[model samples]
Target: MESDNKQPCQTALYEEEETLARLTKTANFQGASGINQQSLNFRKDQMCDSPAERILKQLHNKQLLIVNPKRRNGIILYKRYHAEFAGPGSAVGVSLDTDCQKILPVGNLDLISPESADDRQRAYLIRRQWVRLTLQITENPEPIGRAQKIIEQFEGFFDSATIAKLPDEAFSLLVGVLPHTVAKVRGKR
Candidate 1:
């Protein structure tokens, strides 16, 4: 029985290698040995800011945070009554209708990851940089549709259980909908 599973795993691995080889050929990717250390260092310096630094810069600039898609990190922005959840590839703060990016008192957000507790703690220390995005849904012709679009954007990156943890109030606050309305749309899930 174990060998049966192993056989399929081996076949999948081989297929993956073949696909990678074809991609490399098509992209003209020279092997790792061809890249010099100076080029690698320059690229790293340009693109690899410490995670905390990146978060700070985004919030400070009031830039809609486009979370790194390759990472599993998620962030939550908490207000007095609600908290917004943003997963990878989702924009967390700032919206078109409003320029409210207040992050007063700094304990308003948390970055979560499946990694070690140390990483979670590190994120907490950087919570002061967290910014809240205020979106005005009433201005939209279809308020409910606007709310649903916001909900779906979050749903795209998080699992059902993760979504469940976020209160209806959070979603409502995000898109300026009633909690009950958020519940109604969520039920349609």
Candidate 2:
């Protein structure tokens, strides 16, 4: 009886993986531009929507697509994937860089696999530091002033010993406020 159940379980797992692969592939193909009506229709067909409109409605709710209101036909001008922390066959992770590339802790959070507690602690600290930096940037209005303030606040968060021990990337991220704040600064240079 156990052996009989195993086959069905394996089949279900295989199907689920295949579906995920398809979804990921479709999502990546979209790029930053937009998907056409044909692609949207294909997705709707695959999902078995009785009408194309309903599928589009579902996609809008999921935030996978955005419709242009000015357009006559309610044209979808952009498609965005739901932010996923985990890739295929992987677990949830956190984005650490400005570009949003290079996810850390690439595996199931519950399992922890080979990552140590120290590594997890460092990631947590980085996340906290990012939140702090973001809040400081938002609260301040002047660009140069905000940048200087953020730098000072970041420095104040660490002691001389800890500052010397901090990673280059962490420092870069902490001090990377200038570029982000410049947009809000008055007058073009």
Candidate 3:
């Protein structure tokens, strides 16, 4: 169970959507001095005018967008996925959720064993796959439940099939059903 803190620029971009809206409307971002302090602000020295400014920088660095903001196409999440590998001896495999990349106060639920050779081998394949899973709520331990559900679901479609055993189509299928179920995300609220 983890959440992504990988792309700060991405984080900034989404978080600053409202600010960007204001900036686009007014074509101005004077930072802390501006009336929209609730959504936008400038730190001391002000290396950049806004989060949008930094997002542009990151986009350019990644070559996802051009240097010109006037003609720039914003970065879009074309695809989102959780990294996973077949956990040996279990019908379910280990996965790293797009959200779970940090070690928060999430409860104890260790699915991967360090002692097992297969576990170590799987982990060694992708060290950055999972950092931790934090549940946030002490009373509600739903995160663990969520993880278990993911494993259970994965096992439904795939069982003990190593990456090699799976077909080319399997990857695409996994993309649809992730370590965290997608139905809850795209389903009716």
Candidate 4:
């Protein structure tokens, strides 16, 4: 009967609306920037498991992730007051230093385990990559030295145009330098 068909159609439309509302809620919770503010808001006791906790657990497990160059799989590990960019060719989830921070994978990170790496990639991993190198250089005694050295190190790896594209705030956060100091150093180049 027509009534039976109409009832089914109404049920289908209602289900579709519920599904859409759930998706929208998830999207709103995650946000456009990719950081899960919802997870950040919850205390350890209140939340059983979260995406952020999983990332920290992976870091603690010493699982290394290489940023996929083709996708520009960039990640920003940030605390409430600081942030650092881990770009392509950089390793993540390797250092325990990220324990207190949140990992925001900017785009879909094509992460592969080290066991999957070939000989060339293995050799590349042997060298001190971006995050490690940044931490080391930022230990400089003088503030100006910290800023200049980070800029210099980045220049050695990335071309001027590429380096120019990165935000000054990221560079400054890694080295404990002011954003203006990074600008001054970049201007000198």
Candidate 5:
């Protein structure tokens, strides 16, 4: 009689251990439809309000879909990254801080330099609130006029800072302080 009870007890304990191990080992999950190291891919316009458990269940059952729509000529109402992984992305060697090269996910897509159509699209993704990103303006920009002109092309798409060359040692502009702060800092000089 005791042996019969022991079997169920052991099974329950085993289940508990498995759950604990999974939670402790990783912050988020990796679904079959997501990148090899992250969660399932999300579209550019899909609202992301699902609970973690629901997302995990979707991943487990392979019910997620990754959408890569054909690019439009201009920014639009809908745009997002390829996926949303709810975990500390340390596995991808992420969160690196450096001045040479920085790769931030502008909607789960990698952005090196804001020079191509794809890069522009990624910027649009951020503009549409489809994804989150952190970009570094490392290159010493050209003369103020030309550089501002270049950056202007990307205006209304994303918020970024302009590094002023006032020789005041104020090399960094506040994030999202594009036109306003730029004028103020220049006025200070």
Candidate 6:
């Protein structure tokens, strides 16, 4: 009799775990959609009045939502969890220029560089290149083919460039930044 009762309880626990896993996956998928603020607000209204806050609370106790002061009306934005694993907004890494030699670190790249004009310019150019390339690659119907062509065309762009001229310290910094950027740019619908 006790065994029979325990069987049902175990089944219930398994079901609960499955449900939680599905919910997490759905939340991650929706979050990664990169919906604009208005769309996000609409989604929140349709789904939950405070979706981000709710998700954050679920992920971490004592978590809070904060507003973006830059906007005219402060918009409530949840603090990103693990960016790589979280949502699209919480992506990691930096953007690089056409040469694939320069880097513009995301989130905190500015803090890593010196306050020199040349350094700032280099960083800005690198970021611009990254954005340009990202747009070009994503907008293409055959991104892989296009990217290959572009890469081949600009193969030697970085040959003359030296690491000393770059604002970053390590070549791995450039390497590390690509996966997140690719994920962000290519993971979209």
CA RMSD for every model?
A: 16.2, 17.8, 17.7, 14.2, 19.0, 20.3
Counting only residues 3 or more apart in sequence or on different chains, how many pairs clash (N, Cα, C under 3 Å) in candidate 5?
5
Residue 35 of model 3, lDDT score: 53
Cα error, residue 41 of model 3, in Å, equals 21
Alpha-carbon runs more than 4 Å astray in model 6: 1-112, 158-189
Q: Write the per-residue lDDT of candidate 5 for residues 100-165, one digit (tens) a residue.
A: 121222221211223455644544444433223212332334334423432443343333431222
Residues 15-85 of candidate 6: C-alpha lDDT, one tens digit per residue: 33465556556667887354354644454443442332333332243211111111111111212220111
lDDT for every model?
0.47, 0.34, 0.31, 0.57, 0.27, 0.30
Ranking of models by TM-score: 4, 1, 2, 6, 5, 3
lDDT for residue 31 in candidate 1, whole number 0-100 = 56
- The TM-score leader among the candidates is 4
Q: Can you give the TM-score per candidate against the true fold?
A: 0.36, 0.25, 0.18, 0.46, 0.19, 0.23
lDDT of 1 by residue, 69-116 (tens): 344445555444544445443444434102333221111223222245
Q: What are the runs in model 5 whose C-alpha is more than 4 Å off?
A: 1-142, 159-188
| Comparison by TM-score, 2 against 6, better one | 2
Where does candidate 4 stray beyond 4 Å?
1-64, 69-76, 85-90, 94-132
Q: Which stretches of candidate 2 lie over 4 Å from their true place?
A: 1-99, 102-133, 160-189
State which candidate has the highest lDDT.
4
Tell me how candidate 6 scores on lDDT: 0.30
Of candidate 4, the 10-residue stretch with the lowest lDDT total is 3-12
How would you order the candidates by lDDT, starting with the best?
4, 1, 2, 3, 6, 5
lDDT of 5: 0.27
Clashing pairs in 6: none
